[model samples]
Target: MGGEKMLRIVMFPWLAFGHLIPYLHLSNKLAEKGHKITLLLPNKARLQLEPLNFHPSLITFHSITVPPLETLTLPPGTETTADISLNQHGELSISMDRTRPEVESILSTQKPDLVFYDMAHWIPDIASKLGIKSVSYNSVCAISMSHVRPSVLPKAAATSQVALSSSSYVGSVPQWSRNDHNSSVYFGDEITLLERSIISLSSADAIAIRTCREIEGVYCDRVAATFNKPVLVTSHALPDLELQLSPLETRWADWLARFGPRSVIFCCLGSQHVLDAAQLQELALGLEMTGLPFLMAVKPPVGYASLKELLPEGYNDRVSGRGVVHGGWVQQQQILAHPSLGCFVTHCGSSSMWEGLVSETQLVLLPQLPDQTLNAKLMADELKVGVKVERQQNGWVSKQGLCEAINRVMDEDSDISHVVRKNHAKYTSMLISPDFITGYIDNFIKDLQALIS
Candidate 1:
């Protein structure tokens, strides 16, 4: 073991924690194999992710200061997607791209064996210049990568943005590419989101997807065909089941303790999935109609200054005992693990999708983004593990549709409920098995080594 070679790897993930956390999970596994890792992220995120660093000595966090936005300066510490709304994402992208010099400085000094990254497509150029191989790690599912090419929304989405109405369309696919980018005032002739991904994947030395054949073999094959590169699977880079659980907040603990086993609904739309005021109230009313105790955590919707102001009139008084609606982020892992939680309504982001599959709760998916839409289809249509809320032609998900999806999974007497429950349980048991994870990760390490060899 001592005589064998050790790899030096650098990790450069996207700005979102959803992306960073999974990259870090991959780092933990690589470090366990005696590999050295340098994790590059925004300066502000370093302290928040410090606790998850299992091997402080082998894996180091290197902060990269994002450049200031040319037109609009963000608050002093706005360093990531979580720091801004969805439409303002383009500004952040400009800042990230401007960090090329800093990243180049870091990469040249380190000269690691491999560079792993997702966004910031120009990484391959830097890696080639430094004589280091680069790998484009897929944080989203292969289905999304294959079928849905993420594109930049109109620049109007930035300034002219308003509350999403019942008639508003957030449908992922055709609409993204359907629009003409010929006349846009965005980062002023900057690359589109889809273009960035394409450039990154096409230019990278290797592709490492955080997925397994069992769940997405066909889609993975499609991705490989599209990119004409071998796609390595890291077994979904699922969070380590053995890691110690973070303590839940006492207020949340005490309130959740009041409910019976598997009797509460937990709905979280991730940190960045914003809904409008009416949408939020409708979702709350849907849960209320379920006549079940619930916990909902969400980001502030457009046009809402605060959660208190965003709520429907009589919302607090009406759903007093049954609902706990929070406006900001929450420890979803802790909440999902609670005994009283039976159902999870999610936005079907990659992390939440994996978490819901592994947890004991049945799923109700309301996917908003493109990647999320495909992920929801995979879970509900392909895996039969959950039910997706029905959307109208205008891409609106009504309160009734949401309530029905939840009831389909939560009603013990319903045959549909039993069917999905059995499938979800069966997959959950297999996915979490220690041997299953080890086999995939072991193969993944060999593949990683192969790339360098």
Candidate 2:
């Protein structure tokens, strides 16, 4: 470490909370190591990170205005993808692409040593022109990245139809070709983000992922080989602060306290995906059939004013004492940490996967998107810490399938449940070990310093 200079790093994450939060966490970690960081985010998106406390001396927040919604044909004040419907994500990506000038302006003024950019393909080129090194930071896990490498993806056929639902999209999840090669074929809006991710990875000096080798060691090795770049794992990024429960959280805590230890299921799909009326009804019926106490956080589909409107008739009264359906955001981390919370019926996003793993909550994966499906496969097939709900050939999860998955995970005597619990315990201990995070971060910083030097 002799004669090494402290670096100035610029962090530019994608316009999504999932991506932004991790970047901010990484920024905080870097700041703790005495490096200066300037985080560039859209004006509104910056507000979401304001609540988090960071080392003020080393970390600075720079807000860049997103392109006008009118030009993008998006809703007013739509700065982040969460502000818009899933169908409008491509337009949001287009808007994000237009911020290159703002990013370049900041780079010109700040003159940072290195820039870490998310899946924005243009940033790497800009960094190159400015003679600053750039790294691609993928918020998704290594397994998803490895499976989606250009060589591994399937070629789209001319006759390929637009998928009816996100779940039906063939290339969204990893599929094997006839030649025994892992491949996926993306169509429509998925192509835009996928292309950007590929380009960003291809253009970067190196790549960083928010994962640890303990969980996805093979995938990490494969990703480094496929991308032909130094891939650094930032370890599993956990919440920087302990969750402070809100009034609603207090109420839910009171309700959960009545349940036996590890008896309740916490069902929440991550922010973006909204279930259609049919899927909602089926899920409701499935949870009702379990008769186990559950707290479900939902965002009703378009045209539904509230959860009551979207849920099935008499559903509330049928499960009144045992179930609570709270609309809008809930304190997911706090709930997961609760002792009564036995299982998490999750969308299998990286954040949710880490949270569930750390909380030692059994995972019942109902993956709605491709990346999530890969995460589900990792948990269910590779890690043996979760079970994927059975989906029909058309990728539909029926009420029976949902019920079976929940029952299987909750059943203490079942082999799957026992294994899941054991694996969860093993992983939780490893992740929370004192040296686990510190050692990875130290090695990561040393590697970066070596590269730049």
Candidate 3:
């Protein structure tokens, strides 16, 4: 960029939108600096991301069709975790591995200066053979990336697991992570997630995590040491507050406008992590118990036709004016940015975490998946920017727990509320400061150039 060469970078993220979206945002940032970016993703995702592409002149979308899987039976057009059940994401991981040939061919012909990837662990090996640099770009935080040092796990067929029981699981893994990693939710008949992650981290030339020193400096340093690679943090690449929020449905804007500023709770768990009917009822009752207005966006729980079907008996009738639990996706960024959004009950995905941090809303976490569990810990435990809903030993959240967490943050007089409020504001101010994100991106681009130089 400084009269030096611009790079042609390929972005091949895991099939899930959580992974795909961040990679695309990184691509946009790189492209803005005049680097040519070719993003390889499923056709459907390509279509969905087209509108969000800020640098169409320099960034191109190349769709990769998922090859057939022998061990898994998926309905037609399941390309991402959003398309399948939470536990079935291992199937998606297997499909990503199966695309190695297609990706290799693209790399061979394109011969890009560098490629950024995660989950597709084989990319670094193939890129090295082609004399190309590969950066294992983890869109999640460094904590999950550094959880294992890559040498510990071995790949096994997606058919039957290689058996990592609690007895066999090695050191420092919290009970939540251990339970999660051992569950079918983390792995499938293909290679396990631990293997996919560490293998990629070990082989890649550089490791970039979508985090910052403010939130996860120690974890980032640990990751660099663990992999012996230049581990760089992206400094919150999905800077939604800086970008324009599109008007999704006028009704949401209209409905939200009626509430006083910072008075309504905006609840939207991520695309995955669908609650059961029982849990959905608990969430509904919990928000209702807070006696605050809310807008909750979620799908019907398992076996229920709609969100309406899972409501507690006469639940809607009782909380009719105060709560609205609509089914399906909403423009979460816009919803979070709303003037009326007082509290955000989130799944603590990387995107949601960044968004909540940058916003003025109070953070109340209800994390479901394993990575999300760690993310919740970062905010609720380490950073003390939010309060987490206490869970039963079996990991099910109750209505009372959810209600208490929301009220704790929303309560003006409570000490815990005062702490999270003060801390959340303090960090948010640092994140939005001038040159905060730009400094990281400009320095990161130089680091990338250094790799190819």
Candidate 4:
């Protein structure tokens, strides 16, 4: 940053924690590069960012009170999708759309050099009115982005009215067909998300994707061609999760230490996507059948009062010493990085994928939604760093299926396991290498400078 002009950037990400965290990570990187970041978030969602330990001087938190949940006919304290049930996620997206005025007001006062927005479809127009440049900072991977972009799809599918499901579009890549949930509530209605994404991308001065050329160069290229806009790859801004262990983290760490190296399965389904009782039962039984040490963190599905109510009878007693099932929040990055973590059973979210890649742990993918399904495909089919667990035609995982997939990835002799471990090691070395990350950040800042100039 020597003799460089310091920039003032306004960042407004979607209301979800998953989206917010990545935006904060990017803000941190920009701040480190001598830029000032004004992060606009809902009051409650702003609380989620406080723990991330951002640079106090360069990054400022500006709270915008979201329209009350009660007024929106949504649940109280529902600032993010993580605070509500899956079915109610659509309301959260719609509710955020109502924050346009608040955002405009912030822009009017901040007079920032640029605005980096995610999923806020109306941002570009507002920024343009203020003569401020805007960039659509996508936190998702390039594969998912390209697959969803209409111009990248086949002519027939692209012209069709039906929204292409993630499995149908991405799984159909090459010669594959897999059933997946038709849509995701996380981004609201499928058609709406597509329209919004297209609008936002169309309006932005440039597109910033949280991916690297090594992983999805072709997709990134396709994105640039499709939109006819400059595409900037930020690589994956991996968050620093090496904070001192809390009491709960210490307990889990101590428990994992008892296992032999690379022998424990770490299962976390992220903040969203709770499991129903039947799915929970099958998953519990599956983990029990593995006969391997495991730690699972679950959020009980809708209508279930607690995790205990969702567990199968005597399930806890049966797997007493072999497994631990804790409900609610868990320090996921700490668990993934633990020496005993043999495999990661994940929902295949982009952030989780980056963490898993950095951890060098084999991935056991259990994708619960559309974007996750696409992520699973890229990890298993393209990257070859993970194994997607087999699900029934109706898209449900059984006890045996889960056990077999977990065992397959854990087994050293199996070809899938071997390839996954090999690829994981290769990618991990590249990701953690100092040169790779530094070069990526340098290029990203160069792109931002060009945009402003």
TM-score sort, best first: 3, 1, 4, 2
Tens digit per residue, CA lDDT, model 3, 1-453: 778788899989988888888888888777777889999999999999898888899999999988757557665778887777776676667777778789999999999999988877678778888999989888887776657654454332111111122122322334444434453334534445564555667778888888888789999999888767898777887645446345657988898888899999988888877888888888888888889999888878767778877788898898787789999878887788788999999999888998899889999999877878889999998999999999999878887898899999999899999999999999989887748888888889888889898
Q: RMSD in angstroms, candidate 4?
A: 5.1
Off by over 4 Å in 1: 1-4, 148-189
Residue range with the least summed lDDT across 10 consecutive positions in model 4: 171-180
Model 4 segments more than 4 A misplaced: 69-72, 150-191, 241-248
List TM-scores for all candidates, in order: 0.90, 0.89, 0.92, 0.90
Q: Over the stretch 1-453, how does candidate 4's per-residue lDDT look in tens digits?
A: 867788899999988888988898888878777889999888777766686736778899998766765645577766777777766666777778778788899999989999999778678778887889899999988887785555544555454322233223321221111112433323433434555565667668898999999998999998888777899998788755553223336788789889999999988888777777889878988988899999888887778767887788898898788798888788788888888889899999889988888996779999886778888998899999989889999878999999999999999999988899999899999997767977898898888889999
Q: Is candidate 3 or candidate 4 better by TM-score?
A: 3
Which is the better candidate, 1 or 2, if ranked by TM-score? 1
Model 4 lDDT on a 0 to 1 scale: 0.79
The alpha-carbon lDDT assigned to residue 430 of candidate 3 equals 88
- The residue-by-residue lDDT of candidate 1 on 1-453, one tens digit each, is 245568899988988899999998888877777889999998778988887788889999999998776568565567998888876676777788778788889999999989999887778878887888889998888888886332333333322212111112232224332122332323212555555566677777778888889999999898777666778998765656547446878889899999999999999998766887778888888998898999888877877777888777888898898898888778787788888999999999998988898899989999877678889989988999999999988777778988999998999899989889999999989888878877887787777778888
Clashes of each: 0, 1, 4, 0
Worst lDDT window (10 residues) for model 1? 158-167
Candidate 2's residue-wise lDDT over 68-159, tens digit each? 64744688888987887776766777677678788889998888889998767668777877878888898888888886565433333211
Off by over 4 Å in 3: 154-190, 240-242
* Pairs of colliding residues, candidate 1: none
